[model samples]
Target: MPRHDGGEKPQRSCLACRETRDRDRLIRFVLSPQGEVVPDLDAKLPGRGAYTCIDAACLAAAVKQRQFGRAFKREVAVPTPDEMTAQVAKLLLERVMGYIALANKAGKIVAGGSMVGDALKSKNKPGLVLVARDVSEAIGEKIAAQAAGNNVPCRWVLTKDDFGALLGKAPRSAIGIKSSGFVVQLLKTIERYRNFLGEVQ
Candidate 1:
């Protein structure tokens, strides 16, 4: 069946670029009989399928290693590394994004530092804070205090500066000066951290 203009949008994320794109723009693959790997251009398959972006290098990485083996928990022979990478990237992207969607739907998110502060003031603030590692110390401290005062735990998002780079447009500003811009996907990230902390506690 042909998809209409308003029909479902097929999406896939690139492992190499850490970007989400339309599924049609990517390649799909499935583990075939006799351990041979097969590309599922039509996306119809009986067993598990994976996807990868058009990056040949990433495809190479996927095939030379245990990427698919770990994902599927079985040693399925791949004719080419490229085939394995496509399926692994696709499966990983979907798995990650699906959890994000679930967190969003559960209202476990609060984006923007100012908005987060407001949530602190509100009756229901988050139980955890995910501050960017590159965020200014003064700003980070203040946010930390708010979380601490509320009995919320504060954690740096990651050790690498890439976390800040990946934050896109999230602002670095004085607390009372102006509002930090909103990021849709960041809410899911923060919520995931919150859940992670909950599990540890």
Candidate 2:
């Protein structure tokens, strides 16, 4: 499809929505050697790729309408709607976790509620505040208020245990990303995740 903005970025039309958008905004799927439809999150699997918006509704529509079959011009093997949704969600979550690990290794993230609160108050405020889903209500509220006061965007996803596992430490209630690049990348993945679940985020 032609670029909607006449820009350099490659665009693909969603097989379900039929709306053209930047390729990155669409999830790419390709046929595996065994003929199963597989999501290529990295867009690197070699084959004619199919596209869909990062949304459960769009995915369902595509599956219901046999859009993938038409796209491939053959009987492409696709999972049931529920299985496909779960598979795509798992892939997106993995990518989010990978970015978290990379950001932590680069020293762009600081964990613990107190540390994150401090970072929000520092001269170099954090680009984003990430709270644990299992955070204590009191501290969670405090940290959220601090992030708001600092005008930092706050997010909630994984639990304290998930944070600890990734950071190689004890459980943490929160973390702050100070690097803009990492913040941008994390938010992009999070947004896709939110869209998939139709969540407010």
**Top candidate when judged by lDDT against the true structure:** 2
Taking all chains together, the TM-score of candidate 1 against the true structure is 0.34
lDDT of 1 by residue, 1-201 (tens): 244477767686543444666776555667877766666645788887666555555456656654656555688777576455445445544443443334444555565567678877887666555666667788788888887888765666542243223333344331111112223343434443333223222
lDDT of 2 by residue, 90-185 (tens): 888888788888999999888999999878878998898889988889989999999998889998888899899999999999999886699999
TM-score of each: 0.34, 0.91
Clashing pairs in 2: none
lDDT of 1 at 74: 80
RMSD of each: 12.6, 2.0
Once fitted onto the true fold, the runs of candidate 2 whose alpha carbons sit more than 4 angstroms away are 3-8
